[model samples]
Target chain A: MSSLQLPILWAMLCLYVGAFVLDVYQFFQSNEKVKKAAVIVTVLAVAVNGILVVLRGILIQGLPLNNGFEFGMCFALAIGIIYLILLKKFALSQIGAFIMPISIALSCWLLNLDMSVNPLNPSLRSYWLSFHVTAAVIAYGTFAISFGLAIAYLLREQGKLQKMPEAEVLDEVSYKMVFVGMPFLTIMLITGAVWAEYAWGTFWSWDPKETFALVTWLVYAIYLHIRLMRGWRGKKTAILSIIGFVAVIFTFFGVSYLLPGLHSYIS
Target chain B: MHKFLRSLASLKLAIYLLAAMAGLYAVAAVYGDMEIYSSWMFRLLMAVFWLNLFSCTVLHLPGAWRISRRKAKADFAGSGYENIAQAENCSQDEITAVLKKMGFKMDTAENEQGICIFAQKGKASLFAPHVLHLAILIIIIGAFLVSFAVSGAVICTDGQKVALPSAVAAKIGEGYEIVVEKFETVYDDQGAVDNWVTTLDLTKDGEVVASGQSMVNHPLIYKDLTIYQNSYKYHFLLSLEGVNAEADGVYSLPEDLAVDVSDDLTLIAHGLSDEEVFVHVRYKGEEQTYTLILGEPFAFKDGISMEYGGENNYTILQIKYAQGSKVVFLGFIIACLASVMFWSSRYREIYLRQAKDGAWQGRVYCKSPEIMRKMKEDFETNLRGK
Candidate 1:
C-alpha cells in the first residue's frame, strides 16, 4: 500500500503544477471562464493531495507528519486546503491565480529535496510529535492564505481610491482570514513549546526555530494591536499583514536552513 | 492607590508588557550572553516588558496626540465651535470613509452590539502575543519550581547501607534507612548489558524491612524517593602464599621445598635452586613468569604495584565482585510529565453564534483544526440534535 501511494502522490504533484500554470495564464487573460477553470483545477488538485495524505497515513500506520520531508509535504497540503476553504467562503476566486502558484512552488520544492524515509527514533515514539507538528503545519498554512488575502486587500484598496470597485469587501475578507489564522498560530506556538520540553527537557531554549517563531508571533501581535486599538484598517493594515507574513516565511524556511539548532532535522 | 490597582489589572498593560518582553528576549537571544541569563530571569523580564508596552500602546496616547494636533490646525482654520465638537465626535464609520477617501481601506459595521471595524490582517491574532507571553511565564515558573525546590538524587550500592544526601535526607522524615541487599547485572553474549536489578530493604533499625527490586527504566519508589539502577563496576581479589625451602633441618622434604600458591594469589613461587625461585604471577587474567632470588621478593608493577612473588611454589586465588549504584528516579519522571503537559495543552476558545434563521452560521477559531474540529463536531452534533 505504501509503495502504491508514492506514485499517486507524484501524480498529484503533477496536477498541482498543471493547475498552477493554468491559474498563472488566467492572471494575464482576465477571463472569468479561465479563472473559474483555474479554481476547479485547484480544487481537484486539493482533493488528490488529500487522498495522497490519507493513503500515505494508512500505509505508514499513522499520520505521516513524522519527519522533515513529510512535514514539508503536509505543510504544502495544508496551504492548499486553507486556500480551498477560503476561496469557497469569500468567493475570492481571482486570488486563486496567486495562491495556486505559491502552493505549487512549495510542493515542487519539497518534491526535489532529498526524500529519505527512516524509522522513528525512540524519543519520537510519543503521540505529542503528531499533535505538535500537525497543528503547526495547519497554522502555517492558514498564515500563507492570509498573506495572499492581504496582497489582494492592498490592491483592491488602491483600486478603490481611483473610484474603482470598492475593495472594502476584499479588505474585510483579508481581515477575517487573518483573524482565523491568528488563533491557530497561537496554538502552534504553545504546542511547539510544550513538545520541545517533552523531547529535549526544556520548554523554550531560544533555539533559532523557537526564536524565529517568537518573532513571527510578535509581528502579528503588533499588527493586531494597531488594528484593534488605534482603528488601523485598509491599505496600512494590509501592508502590516504582508510584513507579518514575510516574517512568517522567514521563520518557516530561512530559520530552518540558515540556523542550526534542534530543528536541524528539517534541513 | 485605586488608580494603581486599576492600572495593574488593565489588559492594555498586560499587552504592553508582553510585547516589550518579547522584544527584549529577541535582542537577548541575538546579543546577550545566554549563559549569564537564567531562564527564570529572562521570563520575568519579558513578562514585565510586554505588560508595560501593551498598556501604553493600548491607551492610544500617540493617536490622541496626533488627533489633538490635527484639531489645533482645524481650529486655526476658524471652523465654528459646534462644528469642531461635531468633527471630533464623527462616528467611526464616517472616519473610516474619510480614511478610505485618503486611499485607505477600512471595513466598518454597526449593529446593536455596537460599531466595530476589522483591519485587513492580523487583528484576530492580536491576543496571541499576550497569551503566549503568559504561557511562557507559567512554563518557566513550573520549570524553575521543578528544578530547584522539588528535585533530588539518591545513590545505593549492593549489600551496603547507603545514606541519602544531606539535603534530601533532612526532608525524608525520621524512620527510614535504605539498605541494598544484592545488586546484579545480566549481560548479553556480546557483552552489552541486558538488564540490572537492585534488591533493596527499607529498614527502620536493623530489622528485615520493606523490600523491593529496581531495574533499568523500572524504578522502585518508597515514600517520595525512587531508586533506579544507574551503573555497575567489577572488583577483583588475589592471594599469594610462600614456603621456605632452605629451612630444612630434619623435616626437609622435596615437595615442601617448593611452596604451593592458590589461584587467588597475584604471584606464585617454586624453588628451582637454592639461590632462586621460579614465580608465576597473574593480574587481570594475564600471566607473567618471573625468577626471584632466594631472599629477594619479585615486584609486579601495574595499577596495583606489589612487592612480593613468594619463594617456593605458591598458590594465587582471584575473586571478582560487581558493585552497583542506584539513584532516585522521580526527577526523570517529573521531567517527562512536565514536557508532555507543556507541549500538548494549549489553551484556546472558539466562539460560535448561530443566526436566528436556523441556518449554520458561525466563526471557527482555533490554533489547529485538528484540535478544533473535534470540539466543533461535538458542538455541531449537539446543536443539530437539539
Candidate 2:
C-alpha cells in the first residue's frame, strides 16, 4: 500500500469512530445541548464518510462498489443519509447511536481487506451493473432505517426506551419507509435479472445472490401485505419488519461472501 | 357477485399467497439450484395472486377513485367521523382558510344548523395503492410474455459468415446474412482487457443493408433483431504442410470444437497442460485420445501429421427478437413513477360543523396527527393571536 492511501482511508474510519463515541456519550448525557452536539458530530462524520465514498469512486473510476470495503462504505453512506432523513420524522439521535456502531464495524472489517484498486472484472462490466448496485444501495439504505425504526418500536412498546417517538408512530413510519423503499428493491431485482440475462444467458440464474434477493423481497412484501389486516399491528408488524431487514442484511452482506455467485465481484 | 367478489378480493388471500411465495423462495434459496419461479406450483401461486390483485383492483379502484374525486365536505354528517377538534367562535371561512393552509382542498355546504366546511388533502394518494397493484400486474404480464418469446443463440468463429439462428433471415422473402468480419480485444495500458468488439456486416438481397460494431452493452440492431456480442472462445490453430491435404492446411480446434483431419477422421484439441497437449480423435464411431508435446507432431492412422500452430478467438453472439421487452420496460417505468407518487404523499380530510351550543367544531382525520397539530397551532396563532 502507498504511504498516503492508509491515511486517506483511515481518515474515514477515524471520523466514523469519532462520531460513534460521541453518540455513545450522548446516550448517558441528558443535556439537550450535548445531544445536539452529538447529532452535529454524527452529521459531520457522515459528511466525511460521503466524501470518502465519493473520493474512492473518483479514484476507482466508478462508484466505490467494486470490492467489499468500498461497497460497505457506499452502503454506510446510504444508511447515513437515510438516518438523516429519518431524523426529520423521529427523535432519532438515539437511533443513530444504535446504527453507527454497525456502520463502524462493517467499514472497519472491509477496510482491513485489500484496499488497493484493481481492474474491474469483465463480468462486472455492464451498464445494468451500475443500475443494479445503485438501486441495491438505496433499497438497503431505506431497509436500514426501517430496521432501526422497528427496533425503536419494539423497545418503546416494551417500555425499555424513553424519549423516542411513540411505538405506534415508529411502527407506522417504519412501514412507510418500507413502502417507499420497496420499489427500489423491485427495480434492483428487475435490473439484476436483465443484467443476468445479458451476461449469464438467463434472467434468473437460481444463483444464491438472486435467490436471497428474492427472499428479501418476499419478506418485505409479506410485511406490507399483513399490514393491511386489522389485528396485525404493534408487535407483529414490528417483528416482521425486523425479520424483513434481517433478510435485507443477509441479502446485502451475507450472500456475496457466504454464497458466492456471479455477484461475488461486489464482495 | 357480492359473495364472490368478497371472497376473491380478500387481503387474507393476498397475504397467504405472498407467504406461500416466500416459502417457495426460501426453499429455492436453500436448495441453491432449483428455480422457484419456473415451477408449476409457484406459477399457480402467482396466477392466484394475480387473480387476487386483479379482483382487489376491480373491487376497490372505483371506490378509491370516487373518494379521490369527491369534493371536500365540511360536515361530519356525511362521513360519520366524530369531531376530533372544535374551533369554537371561528367563522367557517376562517376554518376553510386554516385547512387550506394545511394543504386541503376546501369546500363548504350550507346545512340547516349552519355552514359546514370540509377540506381534503392528498386525494391523489388514494389512487396509489390501486395503481401500484395495476403496475405490478402489467409488469408480471410483460415478464410472462418476454419469457416465452422467441430467442436463439448463434456461435460463430472470427471471419465467419452465419445467419442468425433465431431471427428469421428472410423478411418477406429477402434473405440476409451476418458476417463477423473481425473480433478484436482492446486492452488497457495495464494489459487487462478493457472491452471486446465485433465488427459485423449485414447483407440483404446481395446488397449491404447495415453494418457496425457490437460489444457487451452496445448491441447491433438490424431490422427486428438485436445481436449481442455475448462471449468469446479461443481455438489453437494447427497448420498443415501440404496444400491439398486436410493435415497440410490450417485448422482451428478447441476442446469443444471438432476439425476434420480427413473425410472420416476428426481432431479436437483438449488443452495444453504440464508440457503436454491433448487432442481427442475419433474415426468410424471409435473415440481415442492422443497426447503431443508443444512443437511436436502427432502421426494419425492416414499418415497425416498434425501440428499445433497457434490460436484464434471466436465471438459468441445471441440474436433475439424480444417483442414483449418494450412492454416490460414500460411497466417498470410506470411502477417506479406510481410508487414514488403513492408513498410520498398521504390523504387527509378535515370536517367543520356547528354544535348545539351555536359553536363551530372541526375535526381532522389523517395518517399524521403531528401535521394536524401543527396546523391547529398555526390556526390558533393566526386567529386568536396566541
Candidate 3:
C-alpha cells in the first residue's frame, strides 16, 4: 500500500509469470493434469491480485479505480476471476491456457503505468462513482472473454471444415459466451451515459470516449442482429463476434489514449 | 391489447431502437461542432432525436408484432420444438419433420446438454432494449424541460436592486426583490482569484425578508431558486496632469495629448504634471470644459491605454453575477437514479429440464452475466456445497 511492499508484489508477479508458462505448456501438451494445474495457478494468481487491490483500496479509502494504472490492474483481476469461473462451470480448462497469459500481460502493462494517486474532484465524490466504474470494468472483462471465445471459434471453424479435431465445439462456446457478454455491455453503456449527465451538464456530449463507446455498442448490436435474425451460425458468427470485441478494445484503450475527449482522466 | 403489448416489447425492436440512436447521435456530432449551425436549430434537432429515440425504446408493440408473425410462420411450417429422436437412426426428412413438429425451425444438437434451437419465444426479452432506451429519453426530456422552463441569471452591483428575470421571478411567486448588499472578491498571493462572495437580501415589498452570502460553487437557494457565482470583470478610475503651449493657444504639456482649434490645428500632449500649467481642452461633444493637469494621467473611456513617464497604467475591478436553478439539479439526481435502476435491475430467467434418462439439461441466459456472475457463482457454489 505504501508503494514499498515490493516483496509481495514481486511474488505476485512471479506467480503470474509461472501461471502463464504453465498455461502455454497445457495448450501444447493437451494433458488433463497440466490443464488442471494451469487452472489452479490462475485461481491462486487471481486471489493474490484481489488482495493487492483490496490493500490498495484500504489505503486509499476506496477502490483504486480512479486512473488507468488502477483500472488496468483491476481489469486484469476481474478477467482472472471470470476465466476461473468459466473454466470451472463449462469444463473449459483449455481457456485458462490463453486467459492467464492475457491477464499477466495486462498486469505487466499496469506496472508500467504511472502509479500516482490523483485527488478526487468534487463532482466524483458521489456514491455513483463506484457503481459506474465497477460496472464498466465488469463489462470490459466480459468483452475480453468474448474476444478469446471469438478467436477460438474462428480457429475451431477452420479446423473442423478441414477435417481437423472437431473445432466446431469452439464456435458454439464462443457464440454462447458472446450471448452472455452482450447484455453486460448494454448495461455498461447505459450507466456511463447516466453518469455523464450527472457530472456534466448534458447526457451525451459527443466526447470521443462517448462516440467510441457508441461505436462499440453498434458493433455488438450488429453481431446480435446477425446471430438472431439471419440465423448466422458457425464460423461466420464467431468471426463477427470477435470483430465486435476488437471494437470494444479500441473503445476502451484506443479511444482513451489516442482520441481527445472530456474523459481526460486517462490522459 | 396483450398481444399488441407483447409485440411492442420484442428484442428486435430494441436493436432497431439502438441502431437509430447511434445514427442520430452521429449526425448530431457532425452538426454540433459547426459554428454556422444556429442554437435554436441545434436544440430542435436534439429534441427530435430524443423524441424518436425515446418513442422507439418505450413502444414495444411493433417488435411484438414481428415476433408473433415469425412464430405463426414457424407454426405453419410445422418446425417449432426440439427433435430429440433425430439423434438415432432417423432420415434427414424424418429428422426435419420431427423438428418441425417440435416447434423448432432449425436445430443442432451438440453433446448431451448443448441443443441450439432457432425458435421465437420469450419475446419479452425484447423489452430489455426498450427499457434502456426509454430511460435515456426520459433523462433528456427532463433536463430539457428544466433548461427551458425554469432557469435564469441576474446581475447586481453592491447596493444595487435588480428585478429577477421573469422566468425565475414568476416562479418565486409575488413580493420579492433581490438586492446586492455587498460584493467582495478574495485573491491569492499570486493575484489569482480565490473566490467571489455576494451578500444578497431578498426583500418583500420594501421590507427585508431573507439575506445570505453566496460564493462560487456554493449556491443560495430560496423558494426553489438557486444562485451561483458566474463571473466578473474590472472597472477603473483615471486622472491627468502637465500642460504645454501650442501655436494656436495654450496646450497640454504632454505632446501626445490632442487639441483641435477650428479643426485646422490640433495639439497633442505627451505628458502632464499636477502642479504645472495644464492645458484646458474641450471637444465638440464636451458638455463641461475641463483643464488637463500636467504630469497626471486619466482614462478617457472604460478601457483606453495611457502612458505616464514611459510607463503604462490602468485601474479597474470586475463584478460578477451568479446564476443557478433547483430544477436542473433535480434532473441530474433523477438521471443518476434512472441509470442505476437501468443497469442494476436486470431481469433474466434460465430454463432447465431433465431428460427422461435423468441427464441434466439447461440453458443459462441473462442480460449481463458479467455483472450477475458473482451472484450466479454464489448460488451455484452454495447449491453444490449443500
Candidate 4:
C-alpha cells in the first residue's frame, strides 16, 4: 500500500514495454523464436497485472470495478485475457505488434491511477454487480480486439503486416470477435436495465449512461446487419468495426466523465 | 416506383440514417439531455429504421421461407464427394449419416444423368435474420405497452404498513398491501454504506402472499407485482424531559439536527448514531458534549434533558406490475438466440452427385468467401477422413 517502494503497476508497465518491443521486433523479422518469446513476455505481463488486480480485489473484498481506476484496470486485464485467447484460437501472425502497443499504453496509464481500494457504493451493491461488470469489461476487451483486428485488416489488405493473415481472414476473425463480444454487451445492457428496474422503479429511464450504451449497441447492431444482409466485406465492415469500437470507448470512458448520470459511481 | 421501393429498403439510406442518428446521440451526450432518446428526431429516425427493418425483414421473409422449403441443387457434373475409403461404393444410408453429421439435410431424387444426393446445412437458419428482426420489432412494441402498465412507489419506515395507492399513472387494479418488517442499512468498514435492504411482505385477503428481502439488485415478487427497494431517508425523533419530568416535550429533528426547545436550551447534533446522537448542548452560557438517545428521554439536569427515540427510517420501494415486461423479456431471449443464429457462419450448400464414371462429386458454397474456403477444407477432411 506504500506509494514509494513496490510499484506493482510500474513493473507491469515495464513488462508491457518489453512485450511491445518484442512483438514489434518479431513483426519486422519473421523470427518465430522472437514471436514465441514476445507471447511469453506478454503472458507474463498479464500474469503480473492479474496479481495486482487480484490483490486489489482481495483488499476490497470485491471485484475491482468500484471506481474509474479499478474499472480501467479491469478493462485492461480483460483485453489481455482476450488477446491471449485470440492468439490461442486463431492462427494469427505478427498482429500482436498492433495490439501490444495499446496494451502498453493502458498499462502505463494504470501507473497514474490511484489504485486505492474504495468500497462499493450503495447503488453498486447488487447481485447483478458481478454479471454487469464482467460482461462490460469483456465486451470492452473484445471491442478493443475488434479495433486492433480491423486495423490489421486494413494493413494486411494492403500487404502490410506481412506475416499476418490475409485481408479476408483478418476480416473474418474481427467479425467473429464481434460475434463473441456482442452477446456479452447485450447481456450487459439487459442486466443493467433489470438492475435499474430493481433499484430505480423503471427499467428504461434514458439516462445518459443507458442512452449512450444503446447508441453503442445500435452502432454495432447496424454493423452486424449490414455485414450479414448486404454481404459487406473488407473495407466497409472493417471501418464499421472501428467505428463501433469508438462508440464503445466513448460509452466506457467519455460518457462517464463528460455526461454523468445514475452511473456516477463509475466515474 | 421500383426505384422508390429500392430507396425505401436501401442499405445506403439505412447507413446514412444510422450515422445521422449516431450524430444525434453525440449531440445528446454533449448537451446532457437524455430526453433526446424520446425526441422527435430520434423518434423519426427510429420510425425510418423500423420501417427499414420491417421492409427488410418482410421483404426477405418470403425468400428465406422459400429457401427453407425448397430443394437444394448441387452439380455432379464436375465435382462431388470422391475421396472417402468407401465413398464411391458407400450405400445411400452411409452417405446420409455422414451428411447429417456434417449438418446437412440429405435428399435423393432421380435425374436425367443419375440419382442425385443433395445435402443442405444452415439454410434454414438463414431465415433467422428475419425472425431476429421480427423479435426486435416485437420488443419495441412491448416497450410501448410498458407505458400503460401499473407502476408506483410506496415508501414506509421500519415496521410500517403501506397501502398500495390508487394510480392515476397506472391502469390495471389489484388489491394488495405491503409491510416493511425491517429496514436494514449495511455500512462498509469505513462506515460507508453498502446498500439499503428492506424486508418486505405482501398481504392479500388476510394472507401473507409473499415475504422476502429486497435490495438494490434484488426484488420481491407477488403474482405480477414486483417490489423493489428504491431509496431511503433517515428520520430522527427527539423527546425532551425535565429533570423533574414536568417540562417534557417531543420534537421531530430536522436533517441538520437543529432545534431550539427553549430560548435557553439550543440542541445541535455533531453526529448521528443508531443508539445516540453526539450533540453540543449550549446551556447556561457553557457548552458540553452529551449523548442524546433520539427517542429515549433521560434527565440531564434539574431544568431539562433529552433522549434519542427510534429513527423513522423510510425505505422507498417501487411496486410495479408491468403487463408486457414478460413479453419484453421473452423478446430479448429470442433476440439473443436469433442473433446468434443469424450472424453465425453463412448458410452452406453442399452439392453431392454421382458422376458418369461412378464417382461421387461435392462442392460447397457460402456467401462469406472466407468461410467457404474453410468449410471446403473441413469438408475435404470429412470426405477423406484425413
Candidate 5:
C-alpha cells in the first residue's frame, strides 16, 4: 500500500460514518438539509473509494478487485453509487438510514483487512475473471441496497419508521433493485462458467462458491416470481428480499471463509 | 388431469419449488458435499422443477403471445392502466400525431364509442420473461447432457508424448495423443509463478492435428475436447549407489518414505533443499540425520551409500469432452442477452379514446412511475400544442 492510500481510506471511512450519522439525523428530524448533506458525504466517500481502487490498480498494474480488501472497497463504492441513484431517481432518502451503515461497516471492514497487493493467481489472470467479478460487485451491491430497503419496508410496516417511504414504494424499489440486479448476477454466473470451462475444464463443478451463488440467485428468483406473478407484496416480499440478500452475503463472505472449494483462494 | 396441469403450471408452485431448491442448494453448499448435486433425490427435484417451469411457460405462452400481438383495446376506461390522463378538444388525428411525436408506434381502431389510438413502446420486452424461462430450460438440458461428459487427467514431462486416457479416448475417439513439446513455469518480476505453460501438439494417426500453448485460463480446444493446464508438481528422487546399491530405488521424497536398508539399517527420505535431500538413517540402534547432496554420496555402512538423484517436473493436464457445451454456451448467451433486454427494456402502452364531447380520455400502462408521469406529461403537452 502506498503512503497516500491509507490516509485516503481513513478519510473515506470517516466520510461514510459521517454520511450515516447525517442520514440518521435526517431520519429523526426530517431535515432535507441533513439529507442533502448525507448524500454529499456519501458521494465524496464513493469518489474516494473509486480513487483508492484506481490507485491500487495502478500500484498493482491490474484491477484492484483481485483481493478481499480491494473488492470490499469496490463493493462499498458500488453501494454508494446505487444509493445515490435511488435517492435521485426515486426520492428514496429514507432508506439511506439503513444503507449508509452498511457502507460504513464495509469501509471499517476494508480498513481492517490487508492492504498489500499480491501477485494475481494464474487461474484468475483472465479477461473473463474481470467481467465476472465486476458483475458480482454490481449485483451484490444492488442486493445490499435491496436488503436495506427491505428492512425499511419491514420497519414501516410495523409503523416504527413513520417518516420513511410508504411500504408500497419501498417494496417496489426493492423489487426494482432486484430487477436490475438479477441480470448482472446472471452475467456473473455465465462469465464465471466460461472462465471455469477454460481453467478447470468444467463449467459447473458444484463448488461451494458456485452452489451458494446459485442459491442466492434462486432466492431472488423466488422473490421476483412471488412479487411479479402472484402480486405478493409488502412484508412478505420484503422479508424474502432480506433473505435473498442474506444469501448474497453468505455467498460473498461466508463461502470464502468456511467452505473449501475452487474459490477458496478468494479468502 | 386439467387440475394436475394447473397445479404444475401454478406460479405459486414455481415459487415454492424455487424456494425448496434454494434450501437444498444451501444445504449442499454448506455440507461441502458435491455428491449432492448428482444424487438421485437432487436429480428428481431438478426434474420436477424443470417440469414445473415448462408447464408454467406452456400455460403462459398463449396469453403472452396474445398480449404481444394484440392491438390497442378500444375500451379506454376499462383498459386497466394505472395512470390515466385527460386531454381537451383533441381530434383523433391530433392524438395520433402527438403519440407519434412522443415516439410511440401508433395503431388506431375505431369503435361505437369513438376512435381508440393505441401507442406502444418496447413491444419486444413483452416476451422477455419467456425468453429468460426458455433460456434456463435450455441451460438445464445442457447441464443434463454434460453429466455424461468424459473427462480425465494425464501428467506429462517435457518432450513426453502420451495418448489420451482410455476412458476419455473411448468417448471422444481413439488414435489421439498429446505431445508435450515443452513445459515451463513462467515467473513474474516478483519471482512468483505467473503461469505454467505447456506447449503441446495434438496428434491423430501419427499426424499433427493441432498445436498450441495451454496455460492456466487458456485451454487448448480440439474439436469437442479441451485440454487444460491443471497443475504441476516436482518429484525429488533419492538414489542409493554403491556395493550395497541393491537397495537403490526411486521414491517420491520430502514425504516420509521408510525403506528397509538391510533390515536393521533403515533409510527414510525426510526433507528437501535446493542442494541436498535430507534423510533419517536408523543404524545399529541409533538414529542419524544426513543431508545427501547431488554428486556426493553419503556412506552409511559397509559400502552402502545414498545420494540426491535430482528433481523431475511434470505438468498435469485435464482433458474433457462435454457434449452439450455448445448448447450450454448458446443458453448462456441467450440468457445474458435476455437479462439485458428484460432489465433495460420497459414496455409502455397508451390507450387513448377521443370522447364525443371532443375531450380525450387516455390510460398509460407503465411499471415505472417516473416514466409513466413523463409520458403522461408529454402527452398532455403535445395534445395542448395540437
Candidate 6:
C-alpha cells in the first residue's frame, strides 16, 4: 500500500463527518450559507473518495469493485453524487441532514475494511463487472437518497424538520427517486443474470445474492405500485420507501455476511 | 363472477401478491433457495402472480389506449390547471412556435369557451406501464420454460468426443457430440490461474459443425446450447512390478486406484504430487507407504514395487441449453426500454384559452410539480414578449 493511502481515506472520512455535521446544524439554523458549505464539503469528500477508488484501480490494474471495501467506497461516492444531483434538480438540500449520514457511515465502514487489492479471480475477470456493479452502485445510491427523503417526510409529519420541504413534496421526490432507480435496478438484475449464465452456466440460480437482489427489486416494485397505481402517499409511501432501502441494505451487506453462496467470495 | 374477475384484476391484489412474494423471497434468502424456489407452492404463487399481472394488463389495455388517444378538454371547470399568465392580445403563431419549440404536439379547436390551443408531449408514455407489465409477464413465461432447461458436465482429454446427457441430446439431436480440441490453464504474472480455456468442436455425423473456445466468462455458444469450462481433473497411470496379476493402469484423482494382486496383498496409488505418487502397499494386514517417482520403481519389505506412469489432465466441460432464453432476452429489452420511458419521460399538456376582452390565459398540466414549474416558466418567458 502507498504511504499516503490510509491517511487519505481517513481524511475523506473526516470530511464526510464534517459535511454531516454541517447538514445537521443547517437543519436547526435554516442558514443557506451552511447548506451550501455542507454541499461543498460533501463534494470534496466524494471527489477524494473517487480519487482513492481510481488509485486503487490503477494499483491493482483493474476496477476497484472486487471486494467489500472497494464497493463501499464506490457506494459512498455514488450516494454523494446522487444527493448533490437531487439537491440541484429538486432544490432538496434540506434532506441532506438525513442523506449525508449514510455516506458518512459507508465511508467509516470503508476505513475499517481491508483496503488491500488482490488480483482478480478467474470468474471475476469479465466486462460485466463494470456494468453490473456500476448499475448497482447507482441504484443503491438513489434508493439511499429516497430513504432520506422518506425519513424527512415522516419527520415533517411529526412536525419536525419544519424548515425542510413539505411532506407532500418529500413524498413526491421519494417516489421520483424510485422511478429513477428502478430502471437501473432492473438493468443490474438483467446484467447479473446474463453474466451468471456465461460464468456459472445458469441464468438464475437462486443464489442468496440473486435472491436478495430480487427481494430488493420486488420491494421497490411494490412501492412503485402503491404510489402510482393505488394513489398511496405521505406516510404509507414513505414507509414503503424506507422498507425498500432496508431491503437494499440487506442485499448489499446481510446476504454477504450471513448467507454463504456462490458469491461468498465477494464478502 | 364479475366481482371475482374484478378482484383478480385489481391493483390491490397485485400489491398483495407482490408483498407476499417479497416476504417469501426474504424467507428463501434466510433459509435456503432450492428448497423454496423449486417448491410447488412457489410455482403456484408465481402462477397466481402471473395471472394477476396478465389480467391487470389486459383489463387496463383499453384504458391506456384511450389515454393515448384522448386530448385535453378546453373547459377549465374543476381542473387543477393553474393560470400562469394573462395577456390582452396573444399571437397564436408565436404561441404555436413556442409550444412546438418546447416539443409539444400541437392541436387547436374552437369551442364555446374560446379559441383553445391544446399541446401535449410524451403521450406514448401513457402506455409505458402497460408495456412494462407485459414485458414482466413475458419474462415470467420465459422463466417457466427455463425450468425445463437441461445441463450436464463431463471430463474429457484432448480430442475426446463426449456424449451429452440424454435429456440434452434429445433436444439437440443424438448425432451431435462435443469434441474437446485442446485444454490449457492460463496463468497470470502472479502465478495464479488466470483462466481455464477449453477449445471445443461440436460435431455431427463425424463432421465439425461449430468450433469455439470456452472459458470462465466466455462460453462457446451454438444455437441455444452453450459449453463452459467448468473445472479440471487429473488421472494417473501406474506401472507395477514385483507384484502379480496387475499391470500398468489408469486411475482418476479423488478416488484411490486399488489393485488386489492377491487376497492377502493389495497395491494402491493413494495420491499424486508434482513428480511423485504416494503408493500404499497392504500385505497381510500390515500397510506401508512409499513415494513412487515417475518411471522409477520403489521396492518394499516383501519386494513389492510400484512405478508412477504419468498423469493425464482432463477438462470438465459443462453443456447447457436453455429453451426460452431468447424469449427472456426479448422481454429484457422491452423491460429496459419501457422502464426508461415510464420513469424519465414526462407527459406535459399546455392548455391555452382566449378569455373575453381579447386576453389569453394558459395553464400547464403535469404530474410533477417541478416539471410543471419549468413548463410554467417556459410559458411565461416565451409569451412575455407579447
Task: Rank the models by lDDT, top first.
Answer: 5, 6, 4, 2, 3, 1
Name the top TM-score candidate.
Answer: 6
lDDT of 2 by residue, A157-216 (tens): 888767655777788778878887887898888888777756654566578778888888
Q: For model 5, what is the C-alpha lDDT against the true structure?
A: 0.82
Candidate 4, residue B112: Cα displacement in angstroms equals 9.1
lDDT of 3 by residue, B265-299 (tens): 23343323323332334434553223344345545
lDDT of 3 by residue, A1-267 (tens): 567434445666777888878766754677768767776777778888888788778766787777676777788887877777777666565555445666766776666766655555544544556766786677678777767766665665655223212455555566655656565565565556555544443445577677767766777766766675566767677777677666666666777776656776764
On residues A45-87, what C-alpha lDDT tens digit does candidate 5 reach at each position? 8898889889988998888778788779889989999988888
Order by TM-score, highest first: 6, 4, 5, 2, 3, 1
Per-residue lDDT of model 4, residues A176-247, tens digit only:
888778877887887787777667767788777777887888788778768876778799989989998888
Error of 6 at A35 (Å): 3.6
lDDT of 4 by residue, B225-317 (tens): 777777777666667777234435665554556667666676766446777777667776777777766456667765566777766677888
Give the CAPRI class of candidate 3: incorrect
**Residue lDDT tens for model 2, B1-386:** 87798798898888888788777776777667465567788788878988899999899999988877666443545654444344566666666666666566877667565677667778767877787788878877877876765556777766888875634443223366678888877777777777778898877665778899877766777654677778888676765553344346777776567877766677788655534557787876889887767677766655566676544668888777655566666776776676676665578776667744566666667655666676656655665631
Interface RMSD of 1: 9.0
Model 2 CA lDDT for position B9: 86
Please give the lDDT score at residue A220 for candidate 6: 92
Candidate 5 local lDDT, B1-386, one digit each (tens): 76787898788778778888888888877877778887898999889888887887787777878866768656746745442344555556666777788777987787777677787888667777878888888999999998888888999877899999888999977999999987777888998878999999999998999999999999899888889998877555666655355555655553465767666667776445556667888887999888888777677776766767765567899998878998899999989878877864578888877645545666787876767888778877777777
Candidate 4 lDDT at A131 equals 78
Predicted structure with the largest lDDT when compared to the true one? 5
RMSD score of candidate 3 (Å): 13.8
| Candidate 2: docking tier | acceptable
Give the CA lDDT, 0 to 100, for residue B18 in model 6.
87
The most accurate candidate by DockQ is: 5
